[model samples]
Target: MAPTNNHRTRCGDTRFPRNVILLLVTIFVFLMAAISIAWLVMHPHDPGFAVTSLSVTNFSLSDSQVRGRYEVGLTITNPNKIITQVVLHRQGSLLLYDSELYSKAAVQTTVNLEKLTNKSVKVDFEVKDQHQKVVPPILGRDLNKGVVNFNVVLKVTVRFEAGIWPSKDELLDVTCKDLDLEFHPKTKGTGNLLGIGKNCSTKNAAGRT
Candidate 1:
């Protein structure tokens, strides 16, 4: 049978029919999608993951004296990818409500916080407000029992070579930041021990009035 013009045109590699071209485009798109999926599945990141969460434990007054030492508990963990070596630096400065009392310190710690894991670390800070400084008479009592305001903040830097990189937040409102300072009598309300019973009046005294 003599070859039809349609067959000759097709065999000659002329412009493809619109429908045929559309079909080819669809197949190519599907193939590209498949390749992408395969690549993604095969090329998983070498470093497993980054930090899932970070937190500080608690800051409590270990002693009553403003010059007394204070300890802060903090934890930094890597919950995701594998990290080779993580070195964290934390610095804190505290301003006591009383100018006489204040503290400041800098600290650095290194850990091998593995991927998909958590590590517990403790940060200890001591505040000594008893530096040689004259106090104004109206400023109130000695540095020992005065009302003191204090805050400590911490910043963490993480380096991840094996897995994913992580970023940490600076702890605010916490004693670790060294931002804490005494709020002064105006804001501290009643005084510490001395002011406790000053307002107390016997029920009898109240009845007489």
Candidate 2:
């Protein structure tokens, strides 16, 4: 027989320490979870939108169609501290109720919003003979009330900005349901916007029709 060795394995001692490996794996899992939670807590948020002003001109309604010119003023605010939001130039569609009206005729200037800042954006669109003949009877009632409420659907493409890395673009769809805007036929132009009602809400509509 060979001489007995003091600290040597017998022919088949290939097993590892199971307890140490288990501890290492548990630690790694907890570490990764903690990091994920932290990242979520620090994620940036969407910017803010508000209708600042509105002016309506050449307003008319007939048996054929409703023709009008509307000047809309908006304030885009970025409340984030480390992110930037870009509103693409003349890339949004505005709709009134169920009618697919107000097609964009020109290219609007791009707006670059810095962190913790606000920018004013204005858009003018015309309502021509393309409008639907069937008008909601309530339109006249609301107009007479000095408040013409319009449910506007706005869709725009935007991009997020961070440091160094290229940002991907996304679509933001805002549904201004029953946006109660003050209108005065007695006045020469569009009157003051009472305010976008509290019922208005926004949603991200990327990859949608």
Candidate 3:
């Protein structure tokens, strides 16, 4: 009887741990289901961005030094029906030439867009004097061809309000690629966007679009 009692006690101890682990796993699964349900009901969608225009003025590159003024037009749209409003905080824009970062600028103004509404904003970037960055010889060669391809990338913090619930800030990336600027034959310093409009791709910080 003593040996039997000891064996019974060890069996009880092992069962206790198993029971606890099962309870924990059940609770975890329940919480995950609840969160997933809530997320589906909310059905949040990311905003859309498009590059309406890109123009360059006073553009020059001499001795590897570059100076230019870029005016970028962006159209931002909120596509969420449940979300009442979306706010985009201050953001930074990067100008890239041949995948190399040519210049960077900050958008000081915060943008607000209502649901199913779109707004166009102009962002100006000036690279001159101390703000100018050195360019590679390849860039100069490309500029002489009367057309240059560039890319613009934007990093923005976005927040949306759905009814009374205000979401946490999320980092988003907007990439505009293959923007061709055609310079005037007489004035190489002035240029305009080649195509009608370029649509940019957006993704969240987690790499989800």
| Top candidate when judged by TM-score against the true structure | 3
**Candidate 3 — worst ten consecutive residues by lDDT sum?**
84-93
Distance from true location, Cα of 169 in model 3, Å: 2.2
Candidate 3 lDDT, tens digit per residue, 1-209? 35798899999999999999999999999977876676578776777889899998998776646677888888888787644333343444445464344445645546777778888888777665444456667777878888888787776767766654435457788888889999987885998999888889988878898
Tens digit of per-residue lDDT, candidate 2, span 70-154: 6667677777765665553443444444545555535555678878998987777766657456766666666677776555555
Error of 3 at 126 (Å): 2.0
- Which regions of candidate 1 deviate over 4 angstroms? 1-66, 84-86, 95-107, 128-150, 163-209
List of clashing residue pairs for candidate 3: none
- In the range 30-88, model 1's lDDT, one tens digit per residue, is 97787666545443222122222222212223234344444444445454444444444
Q: Among all windows of ten consecutive residues in candidate 2, which has the lowest summed lDDT? A: 6-15
How big is the positional error of residue 100 in model 1, measured in Å on the Cα after superposition? Answer: 12
The CA-based lDDT of model 3 is what? 0.73
Question: Could you arrange the candidates by TM-score from highest to lowest?
Answer: 3, 2, 1
Q: Quick one: ranking by lDDT, best first?
A: 3, 2, 1
**Candidate 3, residue 83: CA error in Å?**
4.1
1 or 3, greater by TM-score: 3
Model 2 spans with C-alpha error above 4 angstroms = 1-42, 88-100, 129-131, 195-200, 206-209
Better of 2 and 3 by lDDT: 3
